[model samples]
Target: MDTQIVRCRECPLQGCDTFRPLSEDKLEYLESFKQGEAVFRKGEMIMSQGGKAPHLHTVLSGMLIRYRSLDDGRRQIVNFMFPGDLLGLQGAFDDDLSHSVEALIDARLCVFPRNDFHRLMGAHPRLGYDLVWLAAKEETALEGHLVSVGQRTARERVTYLAVWLLDRALATGVADDSNRLELPITQAQIADMLGLSLVHTNRTLKSLREEGLVDWAPGNLSVPDMDKACKFAQYTQIDSKRPFI
Candidate 1:
């Protein structure tokens, strides 16, 4: 597919009725502004804290991190972006950004200029409704991360993170009950996202392997039975509106 047509073609999010409620014509139009290039380099700030919002970005590939750094240089990653995640829509209607968005890998983004985006939302009320839902989902994901950091044991934290990805991948139709899925991320990245030390992450993975909850191989993972894995992680299903028909 041509890079400029990504929103209409390869955007995993274009069909996600929750995040995208625009018609194909609108999507095609929205995608045309995207320019089809690597938006930012890893560690380069896409949107800095306190910066005025300009564009709403949809992750087309690779991962991004939403993080805030302390005065002492300590950082906490609030959320990790996946294939279909949205950035810049979780903030105030008129305030500056509260956190910085950085690519964790070489990532591509479909950029929607804020002015045009607002016009689109006005023209399609369903798009506005869907944006609200997407923001709520980001909040929910942040809450989940908070719980993992605050309450879960090391093993449970690993389980929580793994189960999180498995569920997300399946929900997005990228994986299934078989737990067969692509995993292009590293253990260090997983630790950062889960708020775990590298050693602790290894221990947790070893424990999960011993208990047969999941298996990790080169470039992928096998969950065997997603339900069983979810049970191990104490995962509970949340009900949300079906965003994609």
Candidate 2:
């Protein structure tokens, strides 16, 4: 694998308005601090739970899934990663990872050494704030997911998930103008994320599809009227720029 470093100024993530703009010197420091880019193919594990892959990453392209598994092989998906989302944050200084991150498609990441995190923070305080902001945002997203699983009906839960993923993909520039995306996640994975049985998940998705609310094929997900679907799911469609790393 090539270890050639990607210049921060040339980063695709840097070009996205969703991310906060970096100062020239801070960008320079970032360009210097990064070791390189890492590529992980579809279904490839970037880091496993309990393994020490001591690095932080910013998604440059593609998507990833973070999950935790039990001894009996039951899995619970924690979150999905899109462009500009930071990875390996929760366990920055810990020896073992608390969860595993796997690529849902061919994904690229801007890699930085874990040991230099504090040095980078001490030198640039705002960057440290951005990191904390990212972590807090992730926590809030998880809270939303918990509410979905605990309170929502199966149809409501699945509808909200599709609309939410579509919104995120659109914000990150991964979705096409027609609101179609190569989502690449399986219904089984969705079941894991939503705490549903595979049969129930399939039925809910089929119902949604029949109503023109969603079309969730194996590697694709789309809605005929994205705006209407968002309204149905009660997802606030943001036209404003959002903050990111």
Candidate 3:
């Protein structure tokens, strides 16, 4: 397969929790990737639901959408990849991908061929632990998405997604002082992920914007105060399943 060359500096996740961090020694290894690498492409099956788990993929920049398609060809996007997120992890134990992964935009990535990745993890136990922690977090996020789709009201759905994005941005250290974050996704894509129609998604966004809870514009979103916005959605970071630490 043909791979695109990209500069390591172009990737936003140079020292994120996902991939092995770039120490001085690692820097040389990462610089090998140039800027604007294809990483992966849309419509190409990066991993199958039951495919072999070989090599791991790391997003340096851009986005990837994970989705499952029905027999009739309708696709439902399950998760969106951000900088530093790992792809092709579902088959860590077996062959075949758990879901399909495709690039939502031009992406840069560094790949650890399965054997080398395993060796790297073996040599760096912390990296191994981090990978496990990441997988657990992904599982939790999936559950949250399920709840957002199945139980949350339409207004709540909008809140759920908004707050989710806000929190994710904060985690990645990209949130601004205004607590506003810029997301360049379209309403149609949002609808597909949330299992809602485009009309409903637009209406919900408009409501939030009018209420002063959020500011929405073309390719940008600003939440003046996340505390106030979360309250509007009845949002809490607390996980209900376990006792408070």
- The better-scoring model by lDDT among 1 and 2 is 2
Q: Local distance difference test, per candidate?
A: 0.68, 0.83, 0.64
lDDT per residue (tens digit) for residues 132-232 in model 2: 88888788778878888898888878887888888888888888668788877889999999999999999999999999998999889888888788777
lDDT minimum window of 10 residues, candidate 1: 236-245
Question: For candidate 2, which ten residues in a row score worst on lDDT?
Answer: 236-245
TM-score of each: 0.77, 0.94, 0.74
Task: Tell me, by lDDT, which candidate is best.
Answer: 2
What tens-digit string does per-residue lDDT give for candidate 1 at 1-245? Answer: 13444435555665553343546765665556454444566666787887876767767666677887677866667777766667777443667887888876667776666656667677667756766777777888888888888998887777777777777766555555677767666777677777888888778788788888877655687776667878877887544543420
Name model 3 segments beyond 4 Å from true. Answer: 1-54, 173-175, 234-245
Query: Among all windows of ten consecutive residues in candidate 3, which has the lowest summed lDDT?
Result: 236-245
TM-score ranking from best candidate downward: 2, 1, 3
Per-residue CA lDDT of candidate 3, range 1-245, in tens? 33554445534454443234445544454353222333555444556654575666766566667888787867788887666667766555545665777766555555656545565566655556666776776788888888888988777777777777776656554554456776666888788888999999899889888887777676777776678778766677533221000
Q: Which pairs clash (backbone N, Cα, C closer than 3 Å) in model 1?
A: 17-243
